[model samples]
Target chain A: MNTTSILDIKNLHAGVAGKAILKGISLTIGPGEVHAVMGPNGSGKSTLAAVLAGREGYDITAGEARYLGQDLLELDPEERARAGLFLAFQYPVEIPGVNSTYFLKSALNEQRKHRGLPELDAIEFLKLVKEKIKLLDLNEDLLKRAVNVGFSGGEKKRNEIFQMAVLDPTLAVLDETDSGLDIDALRVVSEGVNKLKAPGKAQLVITHYQRLLNHIVPDYVHVLMEGRIVRSGGKELALELEERGYDWISRELQLAA
Target chain B: MSAVAPATVRPVEPATEVDPWVQPFARLESGALFPQQPAWVFPLRKAGLARFAELGLPTLAHEDWRFTNVAPLKGLPFAPTLAAPTQRLADGELDARPFARLPGDRLVFLDGHFVPGLSRVGTASGGGVVTSLAAAFRTHAGLLERHLTRYAHGSANPFTALNDAYFTDGALIHVPAGRVIEHPVQLVFVASGEEEGRAQHVRNLILAEAGSQFTVVEHYLGRGTATTVTNAVTEVVAADQVVMDHLKFQDESRAAYHFAAVHADLGRASQVNLHSFALGSRVSRHNIHTALNGEGLECVLNGLYLTDGDQLADHYMVVEHAQPHTASHEYFNGILEGRSRGVFHGRILVRPGAQKTDAKQTNKNLLLSDDATVNTKPQLEIYADDVKCTHGATVGQLPPEQIFYLRSRGLPLETARRMLIHAFAGEIIDRVRCAPLREELDRLVWDRLEQDTQIQVGPHA
Candidate 1:
């Protein structure tokens, strides 16, 4: 167990149903470190996120995940969330009839209650939410509507960041948050993520393209292919991958094997 | 418990034999029941009797009631309350009901007979009439004679016909032309648990003249676990350019049987909204029928039912488009848990030459357990060439993705499930234009969902 690290995965092998996706994957991230996991389609990038968030249907056949010196795999998804672990879903769910503001307030209060903190009343929640939405440039009217319902693609992505800003989790995992955003929405979303950075917080960003890293840069870049992190380097590795696609890494792995 | 032979101990009769209700019907008919009524009511009652005799009790062979089995009702010995009961009710008991605090004219009825002592007949602001049907028989006889048993008396439902044949007393509301009733007239029907197996027939008549507007709420309540039977029928007559809202809220005892029907006659350019909320009774069914008899009229039928335990809630709707440029929209949603069942049958008929007609129907059900059952059918018959009609029905458990999303946000599994279920019901509750009623329903429904232990939060599939 790495007590100082925010997340530690040791030989983690998991899959959905019976097929293995993340095979023998190992990673560790300490506080204040921003790590980006770059991978192509079908490279098990989302499996890792789903496993960490305790999504059902994924079986962790072997190995373990340790978060803040505790077994992350043992905790329920809500327990993990209350323990300050967050996963911004790749596709935001549209929950009809549930007001966005009310949903966020309930989530914030549940986490607060778990931490032995007093729950915020409606007025206090609205005040806090008003300040958080401005950070992501979200429309106030969206708060009145159902959660993520009738939202455009860019609006949904921005809403995810806005929720992350309000929850203020210790470990935030961004899963394909920049997939369907326009250039302006990309900048706004990335800027919002950058503003939420703190010395005590750690972020694990998963993306296919390096365009998002241009705004919210990461300190560490890891290349994931065939369910394993084959290469690791500094931030410049993203630029290298952008210049030269993921084919070279696969060829290099094949040559080495 | 009485000297009469218990149904369980009696021998089973043949299916082709006459219904046992014939004896009770003959006894009640021989006795003097409201002899002071006008001469015209006699013929209407006779016609209703003949219709009920012709229709009889609906069996599994009936196509309209194929999913809902009413055979359980035949085995029970329920005595109809032909006259007023001497049962005394206190004021505090009335205050315990939902929407009891709403400031409006309330007519209280016990076992289907109006109780003047427990009621408050306030004067309408715009020359409207809000009184008991018995009282209106003397005050507004013309309106009652013209509208009472005129719209719903011809319904094919045996329960509606039974109500017409034996209905003792109910509410009679008349909104005159251009008159708007500010406060909704509330008719509270309380079922006292003093006598078990008691039957009550309720009849309500609502007449809104041209340019008039009003809202009426019919609330059915029960005390304890009395196995009562309530057969209620409401007839609404909307004149040209009239706007009206009718809400039927039934929360009876878990051991009771409730059967009700609401028939509306919409006029030219009129807008009528009917809302039904069913939450109790072991076996309950409500029928809503609306006819767009004039051009450019709009009608909205919205309903929500929550069933648990061994309860069954059924809603049957029929919207008839008889004129061009008419519109009708229906939305019905249900939440079932335990071994409860829910049935929805929506039929939209566009008559010949009724061009430019628009009709939409949607029925969605959420089952909380594997044992919970839902049967939904949407039948659309369009004869006009240039009409637009659409309908869709869905039945399933809570979406796992949505539940996971909420749980990922730190909400517990139970809270997530409850929130989703409440939101499913809120879609229909929010359609209520009355703000106070909507707010009350929101709170009441949340409380009901929270207190229900049968709504298990874990995965049932």
Candidate 2:
């Protein structure tokens, strides 16, 4: 397609608390490309997401990750976020006493300030958030409450997507964002993701089922097994793996090892 | 011996030389000048005065008073309330006190005397009673005599003794059986007068009958140039299936000294929540004692203190689990800025037969300056082998990572640091059940924290 490459990861080996979880994983994402990562549990898909986000309590044993021609591992978590890299956590942290709208605005302004853009005050930010809230069908009352303090599982997942829409990151990593969504919410979240896709943006969707891929329609499918990507193919590969199940892939990886 | 009289004992002593107040059995004979108070009240006041004269003021030698010095009290001469109120309070100033907007029964006292003109009494829709203690003594003498000074006796505290002797006007709140009061009853005590070194002996008695529920808020404020001392005592009795929420807000003037004691007697299946907010005063001390006298009782003691500018505030609490299947919790947090100091000592005791008791205590302090200091001690003494008890204390500044996270979001350094401080204090403020009071106190404390110019936002990486 002759698209410009935005992210290049070569042999990323990382772990949490000194125990390796990502074992020599290689991937490259070009502009306007959608890559769906499907794997069984404990397959290092989340580990790869965490490593890319620069979360604390993780050590990079060996890896080379370049985002927008800059070393990604040298930045802190917030710094990575400011650099247009966003990770939608599988389990979002519930920060009590911090208002939802206030937190989101602060995060948005931080990214804006990093890019030398004028900051948006409360009124302007609220107007911006209101436009995006309609895309996700979220209630206006959710913004008044504390950040995910008493939200249901599905609501929290939806809220994460809503945050992604507001931040508008260049490289968005969805770490199992479909784990707890219902059918209706799944559609809403998928539509939100679709509306945000631009010619200069890329997305890495980490999931365990083929149900979510039916809506987002990834360009490439990668099968991660035992901390490494064992197979890479076209979008049809996800459907074949979904129908055949993960057992055959497990055996194939074992035989290859 | 007569020719060379001994230097030590030369003259004969007078029989009447002994101070009348010093004698143990001396009766306080009311002269004509004594107000025509109730006759039955004289005996209790006389006994309290005699005990106070015998014990005198607390000194540094006493274990409880070791950390606090009463030397400033020695130079002043304090007498009972006989003079008029010197500092006249403005209408706006008085209306700004906490709970002024709430529509409930209120009792106002100025210099230990009831000011009926300023007091407002609403219809008791909850089948309860809210009145002055002096008036209640004449109206419901039997109930007043039986419950007043009952729990606080033998407390071994000199301030309690002084309060018992000289308390002229106080609050008498009685919630009837099977009744729940929708609005909270507020007791406002304002210290104003030119009588420097004058003392206000205040007492409050709250009795909740079986299956009753109510809330009480005690507010202390000062408004004069004179230095006043308030020695206040409150006794709460919660019967079976009753619930009581008691909140004490101490915002006296910086030139004032305050001493308060609260004793709660809880019965079976009763719950008592005691909260204290200490913000002002040169020296303030609060002693809260919760006695779980019946089984299936729950007592919670939550407190917060903010001290600055050489002020000192101390909170000492004791939770006694005397019966089985009772639960008690104590949480006290403090923010010390400038050269101010804070102290928290929480002791929990479980008796031998008090099995299945769940007791937890935590004391946390946030020091905003290098010169600020805090002394926290959490003590647990459990004799019951089957009881579960835990205690912990933490003393540190704001988390640097949290502060930096806010600062990186384009907020100014001062705004970011204040936000963290507010968040740290918010942990406790959020627990306050009263919404309006909680929000007001939050704003007040935030304003107080901002006066410090040397507070550092991000100290660690």
Candidate 3:
């Protein structure tokens, strides 16, 4: 394991209630690397994201997951957030009557406070938001409206990336961000994610399709099957899976067994 | 000697006893209360007294009063406030109240009696009339005879009946035909806590003639912890094409009992917006009823209530449409914590031949404690075949998913909870058409919520 890895998972096991979901998952991603976890529906792709974000109702039966050399499971969801981890939800919740601008400002200020930096006032925050909003091609009016109250499918996905831009987290987890986007929306969102990529930052892109990989190419591709990584390879593996589906991988595993 | 009783101690007489709840109030309704009133007014007062005598205090048995119990009122020895306090209010006393800085003409009442010294009356720029009801009797008697007690009669509510019979003074606003009052006329009632169990009955009359426009606010405040009672009645008459905005804000002591009845009669093509904010009092009940009497009229009733501790807040509303092409929308939200309770009953009625009537009502409550509760009922009665009406009621705590979403964005659990609660309240407060008043209420409500330690998500968690 690389000591400077942004994320390191060792035989991680998690389940909801008494039912197991993610079984014996292990992976490692170093600085500035974008890792994509590809699996079919119900292969526990979302569970991996939820477990990393510290969502309630999930029991980590066994394993060790570290974020930036810290025991990630010990921190609360918000603590993980303040420590520079961001999750772009697949289904962003609508919070009526809570202004988006105000919510984003509060989130940013909390992160800043945790980092021992001065909080941004309204003007400063607006300036930052204005610069980042253009990258996602989001309307300024949406910022004034309630948080995701009446957003379209594409707008909501774009909003997730927009928030990632403003918060500027260290490790971004894009959980199926390309699930509900059209080609134009996909291009815009991927562009926004690409713009936020930095040397000291990293990303874990969870997707079920290869079309998104074509836009923001990943450094490493891991094929997840039934809660475990069956194969790991370079970026070429994503194209091969996209052309030849998961049947070949299953056959390969059968032969190996 | 064996009995240890003296002969002078005659058997306690089992004489007829007036109900304790009605005795003190009944004694103050003599002819001397308003000696200068015309004979025609006497009949109205008599009818009010008669209605009060028949109805009396409502109990839990009454269908409308099922959620609220007024049994505690029977124990208090309350007397009508006939005279003002002897001690002169210190300078700037009225200024300490809400909306004091807003530009307007204000009528100050101490314990329900108009205090000229603390009041500021100016000739309305629009040639409208703004004065105390006591003075309006001598000046605008004809207008009063035609409009006063006409809408808010004693038959509907006991509190209104009592107010009609014993109200000392209140605001009398008359926006003449085709005139527009630029500034809101504020009616400020301040309870000095000069004595406990002081009952203040206030009656306000607002008449906006055809093509007139104006705004009026009736504010009630308590200065001390005295167990006072404020029973108020406001009757509004808006003629054709008139625009009237009315607000009633009650923030009395938690030890006080507050009751108010507001009745409005809207004429053809008139637009009326009625708002109520109930943030204080041990037990408060507001009855707001509006009648759409003519065609092309629009009426909106918006209200918000915040209660904690053992306090109880209740609002009962009735919107009646009697003519075609009339629309009414009602929105009310409440935040209750501690062991407090909130109740809302909204009824919409559309009469026969009142075609094209559009009406909608919604009541939402946020319960921050496991012990806190809310009872909401939304009803509709449509006799017309062509009408649109809808209503809904919801009572629940903050959505855990919403809390998680905010927390995932780096906000602490406590901050996220407060923000969501504020948003729930903002849904209604943001409806205030008046910009300054809305902003003021936003600040005041947030300040009050911040001081509440129970507002945090703990007991519910």
Candidate 4:
């Protein structure tokens, strides 16, 4: 199928600090598609997300990742961000002394400058922020304070999504974004994610539980077991895994080995 | 591991001659101007001269002056600014400054001489006195006799003594008991750009009696490229049940030098806040000392310095608690860019009888370039058994995570770093009590930082 692919990974082999983790994993995400990577502990789901986002210290030994037909592996983290690649971190970092509004403006302006568009002024940017803040059910007061400095766990998760909404990346990799959410927070966060998915964009939702997937339904689900995707299927696979747990995948991977 | 020094006998450099800017000023006397003043004025000047002579100018050998070397002063032609009737600077020149219309009483000093035409000299609503030091030396000699020369005599700094000996004019403010001054009493000390290497010694004294309250702004704006030097000393006495705010803003010329000392004595249950902002000059040093002499007094010292282009800014503060139930806190932050340097030294001492003392001190520095440097030391000495004291100093750059987070939002490297730096500075700037004053300082500092960064990252650079 020759539909424009948002991201294409081929035989991705990555490691951290000289220790191999993501071994011989490959996946492809196309425009308008949402893919979920679910696995048990130590299955390298977050590693896959970090490697795709160009985080440092992850040595991609033998593989190729391309975004919009460009060499994604060669770009810096910031360059990748400017190229419309986003990653919602499992643990959003708390940056003290950095105002949320200022950070968002700088980020948006950089992207605009890269695209030869005029940057937005204060009034325009403030209006845009005020509108997007409500999508995640976040308080307007947080925009005036330091970024995620004293935010609750759920608030921080919602903030990651709020940043995504502002940047509007083409390919977003959400890594365990639902790790610390309750039923209400999970529904709000999933709804925010669903709002950002358009026909020309794609998302790779990384999680350890199917509860998040229930809120934000995925078109494709892959079971990553011991550094390899042992099973791939439609949305029904998630349902099976939900009832059977990860032992089925682990057993099948052992039998195949 | 023994690359070069392990096997060799080191060679020590010879000691150099004392900088000419050091001694002569201390010996100079201005007793003639105060001829009609009190009998103790000349003796105070003579004693000041003697004290300055004994101590002399500090060198790198002294721990206090280690980071600051006055050797650069030797190359500049040095002379004391005379009250020799130089041409007056136009009023328009003074009106163009950032804080031109402070909307209150003002005492204007141009080149160390009081100018009556520019001053809106009077008292606040509470019958306080805002007048020139020369005039107050005559009109209120008794009040000056009690508080004047008292703290100046108690100070250990040589510059304080030098100011007493040679200062031609300054401002004096007094607020009586059970009264409140609704507006700030401003002191504007401007250095004329007429002659190169000219110097001025300016002295200011402020006093508030029991149950009194007021605010004072010591504003120093140096114009011209003539390499001027302003040596200033201010002594404050806050009596029982009094509250006062003293803010000193110094934005001198790039080629100028500034040295200042503020000595404050607090009485029973009094509260005093001292704020120092240093943003100019090639070399500057501020010595701020406060004494908590009575029970349950509060002393707060806040300072911020911005330096770039080989500039050196130094701050030294000592907080002494001599009575029971006293609290003192000091906060100082610095942003050093280019090849600039910053130094901070803080000391808190609790005397034997001072029980239940609480003191806190913090000095944080941010270096924007590899060559920028900061030396910070926070010290505490407590003789009392029941006391809580804490001090910390941190020297760091824009945090990597902060930059990365910003960058991930599509911000360029330069913009992200600058934003982080500005926010770091805003932590201290936002603490200024006056809103307009805070906004003015914020704009000036932001503009300077942006321009400096642009120049630093030029194509050829």
Candidate 5:
């Protein structure tokens, strides 16, 4: 239950292939704080999340990202996951022939082992997953099915959040999780996220609209345009952006430059 | 063919007393077993035996078996076992074996002969029919004559011809029209006795009448008391609107050479799901042929083979789409350890005018040792222009990421590796529709994989 900043990304410049997507982005997420990143399309929001998750193909040209005072960029994607960093992908990869329950159990156990905690057996893991899945309102049948195979878009997003809850990562990044969800599904998913938050965990909510922000209720809202953070403010910034639209922010950033 | 001069082969050096029938190109017991068979079947069996005698046992020089050498058969003194099994059903120790609790009729064959006392012949819901092939040959001769050897032609492969020529006893399952069997029918083939180099040829024919549905599981087990050779052939026919699920689990003793051929035919709108699990035998070869002969038919073929030491396992399959709107899918995965070798050759052929055919095939191999080897080939020949067909093959060791992921979870290195291996093989085994059979095969495969390090020498190995 450390109250220090869990993730500190300063002047993060990252990109995929040869093109840059994240340009000098600075962010600091303290323990228990929920930060919302709202932007238009091509705004580098996903790039920030991907870079934080340590996904390949994204070259961090220059930046320093510290998670609990340890260099985050030096770790692999799975290592980052074991180090309490979870990314809820917008379009989660469908891994056929892999059972969802088994996958989540292995993932959770890997994280626990990294933290010097004992791993749970199948029965114990099933019990824990049964509880978490209930909170997400997901069907138990999905746990028996292949991971995200043939699942609806909304169900895949809910499953991602369910996995986040099971893993209990310190820094959870939700990248456009609300894109494919209906209003009710969006509320349920956001509620699942809110219920998992505690004094020791933080979340970075990445979205394209203020609708999700209204449900998740982020403590800080940042406006990203053209691969950089153009504006940062409290929760009201989301409402202002919803009213003013992203075109104004793009224009203003252009004008300021 | 005048015995063909041993086909330019020498008698195995220091060979044991060889049976006269073991000679290459020697016709033995021809036209003897089919005295009462139909006129057409009598000649068919004779022609098959003649062809088998002419070709002799397939050697590595043969195109189809280029990678599989039959040199071990040279040393075998394979005389047919004609005696009936004396063991009773209750005394057969099946209760303590895997797949014992499977819900269905059980037919046990010992030493190439059906043991009625050791079989449980009844329907799962008191509705289906399970009887011996010999009985079926008398009572349902018309049905047997019409479908037996219809799909698996003896002229196509020499081993298949030999099986057709010599097979004596096998299970015959017939599901009545509109009847759905709740449980699978288990056909267990066991090799027992102190006879060395004994050969057992088993032939099974399963017919699901129009609109009927059922499952059949065939198990080949070796008693390990003596070296044996098992040549088995199964022909399954699903009539219009019918469905059939078949699983073949081969856990014969390592001292046995197992060869099996399965031919499946599907009528209009019929469906068939077939799975093959190979975890035993010194050298095992499986030939699977599926013919979608009617419109809207579907067939799925999935297999898993795990081998170690010098053991060799080969799976060859062909799916022929003869009508439009038919679909076929084939998936095979193998795990090889030690110096074991595995081979997969699968082909999907869509005939002309079969426009809506959809076929997908994938064969993947995971080699755990540097000396372990795999040969995989997936061939698709489509004549229809508007058809969808795809084939893929991959051969490699376990993904390091997956192994490391499991190990990082505090599982011991060996346990983690074993789990990953099991998971790889489980991908195909899990496709088995019969739960009991699937579980049994899974356990047997795991046990065999574990024994690779402990037991290194066997007749088959």
Candidate 6:
């Protein structure tokens, strides 16, 4: 039972185009932990995930985010990915002309290469992907197509989870993974996320509602309002927030200020 | 350059005086002799020679040759090579050319001389005859005389005129009516080494009568030569209810030059898909013209050009829909890098009686470097009513967001960019319906990027 910290974010202050959005955000996740981040609209939930993923056009005013004790801010986006940081995009881009299978294989090989491991052959890759394909309940035809091209809304989200199951990233930021999913897709995606839970790995679930937290059953739930975390409690905190909405947190934050 | 730039290009006038290289070619023509000829051949040669002498070289002032400046060729001593060069190559040395083998017939011409030892045309390919143009002229004189100079009147272009006057040898394929040749007739024209500053005049003609179907793959490969030029002319007569797929692949040396013209006459209900792949040469230009004489004809002109370094590739097409219910589609894509330049001029003309004509033209270019240039114009001139004609051109680079998306997946910067570029070229390569040829071309395009592109690829820490 090795319970070590997989990710540590300290006083992260980030924004876009010179306006600050994240104000002194501090969080930590231990191994095998699923921490839910519930915030209202424009609460900077996506901005936090984007900054952690090293997205461009995001000016980090001041922050110290670390993955496995390595400086995450110093690495480029691809470097960050190679170092085991995965971000499930809120709006996945449609990359034309690139085959899905080819792109995934390239990505997996890149990560393996960075770890000083031998590359996987085609047969070996196909065997692994065929098993992972079923975990997300995705159709085999999607893998043969271009990445995210002509895919339905639910399919793109499922694809994000499918990639997560394949790459086995040390830490993953699911930014609004439940935004556009129906109940069935939500259950499938949650099951896929739950299957990947293991020691030496963690997840930061970012969402605007508590619907996704119900299926995954996070160990802790934190309410973020106006660039700061004003409340954090056990899984029941999600139920309380869902019942009372984010108005309680905003009122409490006003009293504290 | 931006796409919104005004379309105002001042014409550049070339020296109207006689070009010095034309005199040497004329001198070589005087000493050369044909294998066999009828009385009409003499008049045809005289007309071609007289046109070359009068036209000299095309000037920039001419509307057709505006973007492509052949001024560099004026200085080269491109004397026609009458005698074959001594540089012999093995049969297996396809010179890095794709689709080196076919099931039916293959005609190999080295330095404009038919090389029987290197070719493999079995007797199994029966109804259709594939032989050297020289041999065809000596044997099937009537067949050669009927279609040789009837379509491509050399007076239109000087290069076509020169090719008609000095064509020592080439391939001639004739597929009989109602018969379909299962395999393609492959023609490989090699400019042997040490033919530096020399030129090769090659001619190819395909005569497919009614109900005939076949494919012709013509490859012009240049290697080991210091500087060479390939001036070729191909005339195709596609009779009624025929299907002919013609593909020309030009992979000359980076220091070489290539000038080719394809003049085709399609019959009623005939379909001709012409594909031109330009991958090499310092300066290359292709003139493609098709006359849809019969009603209900389909003429497809598709081209893909990948150029880098100081290379220049140009494609000019004019499709005339003379009869009603004719359709023509012209699509050309180019990828330019370094200081290379690409030119595409496509025109679709609908005659007075050519009602119900459906024509579409599109030219798209991808520039990898800031210095690379592309000038594309898709024009339509219609005089008939009840016709549909549309054309557009786009010159741009790979989208940066696509690169970011790929990079977010752990692909390195270089790999992501090279993949995108290959994908850009793949859009055109995939349209090739031939399965093996398409696969082989995909491999070649990837290999070119791996071996030629400046992007560095290796392990990243």
User: Which candidate tops TM-score?
Assistant: 1
The TM-scores of chain A alone, one per candidate, are 0.99, 0.96, 0.99, 0.97, 0.97, 0.97
Candidate 1 wrongly placed segments (more than 4 Å): B1-20, B24-31, B123-125, B458-461
lDDT by residue for model 2 over B1-461, one digit each (tens)? 01211112111212232133234222235433235455777777766765666566666655556566666865666655544365565656678666688777778888877778778775553557888887887777788888888898867676787777777678888888989887778899988846678788788999999989877889898877677889899999999989878999898998888999999999999988899989988889999988999998888898989888888999988899999999998888898877888888777888999999999888888887788888776667778999999888888976654544343333445655666667667777776666776777788667767765354444423
Can you give the TM-score per candidate against the true fold? 0.95, 0.72, 0.94, 0.88, 0.74, 0.88
What do the candidate models score in CA lDDT, each in turn? 0.87, 0.79, 0.86, 0.82, 0.79, 0.83
Lowest lDDT block of 10, candidate 6 chain B:
B2-11
lDDT of 1 by residue, A29-59 (tens): 9999899999999999999999999999999
A182: Cα error in model 5, Å:
9.6
Fraction of reference contacts reproduced per prediction? 0.78, 0.09, 0.78, 0.64, 0.05, 0.62
- Model 3, C-alpha of B58: deviation from truth (Å): 0.8
lDDT of 6 at B440: 78
DockQ of 1: 0.86
lDDT of 5 by residue, A105-218 (tens): 776776788789999999999889888998799998988987788899999999989888888888899999999899999999999999988998899999999999888999
Residue lDDT tens for model 4, B1-461: 01111111111122223336445544444545446667787777777766665666666755567688876665767666645447786767678776676677888888788888888866454477888988998889898888777875746666677777777788888888988876677888888866887888888889888988877888888877888888999999999989888989888888888999999989998888898989889899999988899898988898889999989999988899999999998988898888999999887888998999999998989877788999887767778999999888888877776666676677767777777778777877776766667787788778878877776544311
**Candidate 6 displacement at residue A70 in angstroms:** 1.7
DockQ of each: 0.86, 0.11, 0.80, 0.58, 0.10, 0.61
Task: List where candidate 2 sits over 4 angstroms from the true fold.
Answer: A1-94, A99-102, A105-162, A170-196, A202-257, B1-34, B50-56, B59-61, B79-84, B124-127, B193-195, B404-419, B446-461
lDDT minimum window of 10 residues, candidate 1 chain B: B1-10
Could you give candidate 1's per-residue lDDT for residues B134-226 as a string of tens digits? 878888888787678878856888778778777889998878899887777899998875677788998998888899887889999888576
Assess chain B of each prediction and give its TM-score: 0.93, 0.89, 0.92, 0.90, 0.88, 0.91
